[model samples]
Target: MSIEVRSLSKRYGRTWAVRNLSFEVQPGRVTGFLGPNGAGKSTTMRSIVGLDRPTSGEALIGGKRYAQQPAPLREVGTLLDAKSAHRSRRAVDHLRTVAATHGISRARIEEVIGITGLESVATRRAGAFSLGMAQRLGIAVALLGDPHTLILDEPVNGLDPEGVTWIRELLGSLAAEGRTVFLSSHLLAELALVAEQVVIIGRGELIADAPIAALTAETERVRVRTGQLEQLLRLLAADGVQATSLTPDTADIVGLPVDDMARRAAASGIVLLEIAPIHRTLEEAYSELTREAVEYRAGLTEQDAS
Candidate 1:
């Protein structure tokens, strides 16, 4: 199964949520859906699941629109929100109700309960369950029909460390089984670890669609440090490279390759104490991408006044 979003746009009154977004989530891998809060991540997920209508454009699963799919729950399992179930409904009962709608059997329900490790609280009502437990229950419901594709929105938001690891393994295994797994998360570190590809959005517009490795490579801003700070800065300045001084003896240099820096240092007899190149962390890359798209940029005028 695959998910394809083609110029998907949505609006609420005067507020344009998502704008001409487009991307493809191929089968057999975990694709991270990334954006800052109010970047339309949730709204996009909702539109894909038909929980909300797109003002224009289309979202398709397996080459068919979600609305046109018969037995959508069986083909495309979605967890748009963890708290969609009734507070008073038992964990098992909640799944069973969704199952009943699809005429799924009791045996399948039990299987999903076990898969999600909800056996202990299978009979407990949702109101008393922890956020992690509710997340698991929601996942159980999604997996009840053994869907070929899964879409999760902020799935690891409230999970404990253990729960996070569990979900990681679960998603990895599902992808290994050749299922399409689309995960939307704010946990950039975790996403970097697990996702093979990423789709980035900002203010409902698609920002990037690429493999994780490629995106990281394209955005990599290397950090360099040298001991002969004054001499190094002068040399780099002549080459038009900007360097930030961290200490009298150490400076972080950028805009030049490591090999070039080493040669230059050696020529100047400026024995480099440290010439390390720093790669951008997933968190750093995500922060940089979405900072401009934030609903309101904090400290903007204050910084200007200063």
Candidate 2:
């Protein structure tokens, strides 16, 4: 299944929560939906699953609106809230209740319980379950239908380290089976590890929608350490190449690969001790992408922490 968000927008009275956003989540891949706080990520996800009606445009699954699906859960499984189960219901009973409406077999429910590692807490009441257990239960619910598309929001919000690793691998395997997995999380590093494509929105608008490799590649730079750092920087400035000094003996150059930098240095008679590409982490890339779009600004800085 494929997800298509075409010109999607949502409004809350006088405030516009989302505005003219557009992106697609392809099948057989994991796509990360990212945004700063109050950037309308929740609103978009809600619109996608028909929980909230959009003020304009549409959110579609396989070219049809979610409401058009015969068995919505089986077509697009969602985990919008971990606390969605009835408070007094046993975890296993809750799964059965949900599955009953969709005609899911008891065997399938049991299989999903094992798949989400909820077999240990299968009979526990949801009211007494910890947040992590609730998350697992919610995942079990999403998987009960064997859906083709998985739309999960903050799926690892309360998971332990092991649970986190397990969910990461599970998502990868699901996409490998040609499922469409669209998820939102604040865990940028983990998203970078699992998601092949990223759709980032900011201030209720589409900011970037690209492959992870392409975004990180756009930010790649070269670090050159040399006794003649100053001279090389001066030459780069004269030649219209941008470079920033990171240390007394090293300068970071952008817009040029390491081989190109080495060639330039050799042509200029600059002695270099080290020259290597600096790859930006997904966190760094996200910070840069959403810097101007964050609604809440913090007073604390790195200097203050240091």
Candidate 3:
């Protein structure tokens, strides 16, 4: 199954939560959805699953709207909120109730409980569960229908390190099994580790939709260390290369290759200690993309001001 958002827009009175946003999430791969707070990520996701009706445009799953499907839960599983279940209900009863709504069997409910690692807490009331346990129960609910597409919003929130690793591996396995996995998470490093492609939105608009490798490849930097830093800087300046000094002997070079930097050093008689490429991480790339689009900017704290 594939997810397609075509010029989707949603409005609340005068404000547009999502505006003219469009993207396609292909099957058999994990696609990461990323944006800052109030960037309309949740709104777009709600529109996709028919939880929020779009003011304009459409969100499609397998070439049809979510509500158009006869068996919606069987086609798409969603974890929009971890605290969506009744607090007083036992974990097993919660999942069983959800399954019963879709005519799912108890065997399937147990299968998903095992899949989500919720067996130890299955009989425990949801109110007594910790945040991680609640997240597991939410995932168990989502998986109970054996859906073809899984949409998870902040799935890693409140998870422990072990639970984080488990979710990462589970998502990979699900994608390998030919299921479409679309997730939104603030943990950019974790998303980079699991997702092959990414869709970045900013201020209710589409900023970037590309493969993760391609986005990171555009901002490669090279770090170099040489004894004759001033001479190296002068030489690099002549070649129109941008460099920022990190230390007296080391500088980060942009718009130039490590091989060229080494060649320049050798010709200038500068003793080179280190010359290596600095791969741009996903966090850095995301920061650059959303810098101007961030809705809220934090100012200096009182201690810093003092």
Candidate 4:
């Protein structure tokens, strides 16, 4: 299954929650939806699942709108928020009710319950369950109907390291089976590891929609520490490379590969203390993108006033 959001826009009076945002989530891959807080991530997801109507445009699943689908649950399994289910109901019972809606068998429900590792607390009331347990239960409910597309919003919240790992594996396997896995979370590090593509939004507009490798290509920054740090800096500077000195003997060089830096250093007889590639973490990449946007927005505001 695939999702195509075409010029989707949603508004609340004078404020636009999402504005002409467009992207596609391909089947058999995990597409990460990312942005800062209040960046329309949740709003775009809610609109996609038909929880909220878009002011214009459409979020289509496999060529049909979500509402137009004969059986939405059978086509798309969504875990929008942990608070969507009844807190007092047992996890199994919660899934049963959903299964009943689709005329699904009880045996299938049990299978999903076990698959999500909810069998241990299958009978426990959700109100008393831990947040991680509740998240698992939520996932079980999403999987009940055996939908081809899974849309999860902040699914890793409150999960332990083990639980997080389990969820990650489950999603990867699902995608490997040719299902569409579109998920949103603040956990950029985990997303970087799992997602093949990313759709980043900010202030109701799509900022970037690209493969993980492309978005992270700039993240391959290398730092070189050498005895002749000043000489190495001057050598690299001739090529218009900006090198920053962190210490008397340490100069952090970015925008170039470690091997190239080493070659340049050796050509100048610059003895090295340490030369290693410093990959910018996912956190750093995300922060850099959002920070640049913030500065751009600030400049726009100033220009408008002037």
**Clash pairs for candidate 4:** none
Native RMSD of candidate 1 (Å): 4.2
Q: lDDT tens digits, residues 1-306, model 3? A: 899999999999998899999999999999999988889999998899999999999999999999998888899999998988899999999988889889999999989988988888899999998888999998888788889999999999999999999999999999999999999999999999999999999889999999999888864588888788888889889878888999999889897777877887898798988888999898989999999888766772322000
lDDT of 4 at 233: 83
Clashing pairs in model 1, backbone N/Cα/C closer than 3 A: none
lDDT of 4: 0.83
Displacement of the residue 241 alpha carbon in candidate 3, Å: 1.1
- Per-residue accuracy of model 1 over 1-306 as CA lDDT, tens digit each: 799999999999998889888898999999999876677888888888888899999899998988898998899988977988899999989998999989999999999999999999999999998889989998998898899999998789789998899999999999999999998987889999899999988877887888888766642234555566787788779877777777788666768888888898899888877777777777776777777876646654322100
Q: Against the true structure, whose TM-score is highest?
A: 3
Q: Model 2: per-residue lDDT, tens digit, 63-167?
A: 899999999878888999999899999999999999999999999999999999988889989989988899999999999899999999899999999999999
Any runs in candidate 1 off by more than 4 Å, and if so which?
A: 218-227, 263-269, 299-306
Q: How close is candidate 4 to the true structure, as a TM-score?
A: 0.90
Superposition error at 250 for model 3 (Å): 1.4
Q: What are the per-residue Cα lDDT tens digits for candidate 4 across 63-104? A: 988888898888999997676678888888899899998898
C-alpha positional error of residue 137 in candidate 3 after TM-score superposition, expressed in Å: 1.0
Consecutive 10-residue window with the lowest summed lDDT within model 1: 297-306
Q: Against the hidden reference, what TM-scores do the models get?
A: 0.88, 0.89, 0.93, 0.90
| Higher-scoring candidate on lDDT, 1 or 2 | 2
**Which scores greater on TM-score, model 3 or model 4?**
3
